[model samples]
Target: MELEYDTRYPSVDDLRERARRRIPRFAFEYLDGGCNEDVNLHRNTADIRDVELIPQYLAEHRGSDMRTKLFGHTYSAPFGIAPVGLQGLMWPKSPEILARAAFKHNVPFVLSTVSTASIETISEITEGQAWFQLYHPAEESVRDDIIRRAEAAGCPVLVILCDVPTFGYRPRDIRNGLAMPPKMSVQNILQICGKPNWAIHTLLHGQPNFETLRPYMPAGLNLKQLGAFMNKTFSGRLNEERIKPIRDMWPGKLVLKGVASEADADRAIRLGLDGIIVSNHGGRQLDAGQSAIKPLASIAESFGDQITVMMDSGLRSGPDIARTMACGAKFTFMGRAFMYGTAALGNRGGDHTIAILKLQLQQVMEQICCERTEDFPAFLVRSEITGSAGSTMSNR
Candidate 1:
């Protein structure tokens, strides 16, 4: 893929700043804020940055390739667009934009159960190649139907969330009325008036709703009723009992997102999961929990042999993706980064964000003398390595 992006916004940080200016205050905070204190949110990126890579200028290196194989697909890069809820709130038709970009790039795009786009729509856009992440519904019937829909849509991977036993306590969202029982206050309306571009786009797309859940939801429910229906419908926590049935019936790659401990990783292996994504729900849940990178090193070292170990949360750029893979993640994903891209540049956002990341990562590989995405661990600084690869580096 050609490395082309709006040079005005060359970096993810630039996209984030532009997005902050473009989107409404309430929506931006919903996409950007974390749980109480946001300690873990900040900690996650801080820890990942602490990892350093060593370049070998003298080593013989042909060229760097970012292609990686996971579950049965060899994606264009080691990263994919992560699943994010309420995507349309941040930018109109964001799920579709990202899905199309990802498909064109030959990378994975995961659709969230609560995202604005429905399974069938995204499936049609991606030609049924996108993955689907489910929010464990309280009703067994609802869960079964959603799973069936995903299967019928030809989603290759089914990601079930294990975190978010309860929604995080986000002060900004609460103050902005983005918390449960979502509302459109006069203040929000005034803010929407300020961003005419976002306002017009949202109007054209129609107000965002749980489109995937439309078939199941009762007709004619307002915001308050929608919030109530969401709270009453999802269970949010996963145990063996909840997962065993899904594993039995999915008949495709089953992944557990939000894994943060070695014990949990081991449990996932025993439960016959195909992969585990080490995440803290993007620090949107468990502000007090350890940063995702910390558990990622331990879990990947201990259990990488048994199952596919991937990660998300706190990753922002291509260098961050390299750092995460060097630390032992087989694959990486990001949610806010792509959203920021869309919010900043509208329709061009998804393609631009992917382009930026690919170019950045390719540069890192060339600089480090690494030849392949899987070879990143070999370039990890000795002091920074924390896994079995680190323990056995003397042999290399």
Candidate 2:
């Protein structure tokens, strides 16, 4: 983690800007764009911003701790990197880079089923700090094989993505022809021409193929063909029956991701799963879905003890992370933020992003007179347009 460069941009947007400049346009849009009208996507961040924290002053300034325990394992931070699909398309060997950084920081790193790197590779790099996120395939044998691979790789946590039964309707991808393997259209070729460094890296890396899927794929498939195959292969929908086998087989923690409604939470609790990530797939899956932070309070109130309620989407900075925690989120995860960091700084991205979040969270704790993770929810305040606010000393 080198902070030698001027830390002018503390926000995720700052890193995004750098990332936009560093990578090609098509790749950047994959990380930046959302489904259909993108209303839910914009709302994810805007809703978090509306939250106000009441600052407490004149408290004895002392040491602050960000360490949090989840499912018996203690992590250095209360946040982790959310799994993102086709990460190598954004930056070469992205999962590996993020996994290594998370391992070094003593935090959790999630590996998506469709990400560029294989589970075994990430497991080796992260030394088993990695958790696997599955997009359930229709084939039971294939799904079971993947589960076995994850277990063999020493992944303690298994995250089954319940949303995304169908792929999000991302208009930017359609326009850019940014499908699975990615087509070299005239426009894409022109875009890559402008990004000389990215082009050179791509040339050297041989265009970021899905290493995990190669063995399972048929012979002589191009990028577009691979994309179509993946689209056809996955079942997308996850239900009680699909989850039962996973719960039975996975000896370690079993997490259900993309959970929104109370019904889903109740079902997850009944399934005897270890935890459920309260997310809307980063507002990418359903266009009309509720903001992740909004329903969290009620969900936590309803099923907090039965299952650990974690959240992702709408989290950019440390304050946003703290805001989610205040609203009963046991843990927070950010996908695009770290991607922006890696895209902006290449190999140095994860370290810098983690550093920035740590700094921001510490400042929030200092102002709120809060020290440990458990004291966070007490500072939570519910409001209308402003959403939630942290209670200041005066309110206390």
For model 1, the local distance difference test gives 0.92
* Candidate No. with top lDDT: 1
- lDDT of candidates 1 onward, in order: 0.92, 0.84
Q: Candidate 1, residues 340-379: lDDT per residue as tens digits?
A: 9999999999999999999999999999888889887877
Those runs of model 2 whose alpha carbons end farther than 4 Å from true positions after fitting are 1-8, 58-62, 180-182, 385-396
TM-score of 1: 0.98
Tell how far residue 235 is off in model 2, in angstroms.
0.6
Could you tell me every candidate's TM-score relative to the true structure? 0.98, 0.94
How many backbone clashes does every candidate have?
Answer: 0, 1
On a 0 to 100 scale, what is the lDDT of residue 4 in model 2? 34
lDDT tens string, model 2, 1-396?
A: 343323866778899999999898999998898889999998888887776655456666565788999988898889999999889888887788899989988889999988889998999998776999988888887888888998999999999998888878888888888755456689888888999988887787676766666667798887778777887678889999889988998898999999888999999988989999989988888888888877887788789887899999989999998888887888999999999988888788888888888878978887787788766876776666324444444444
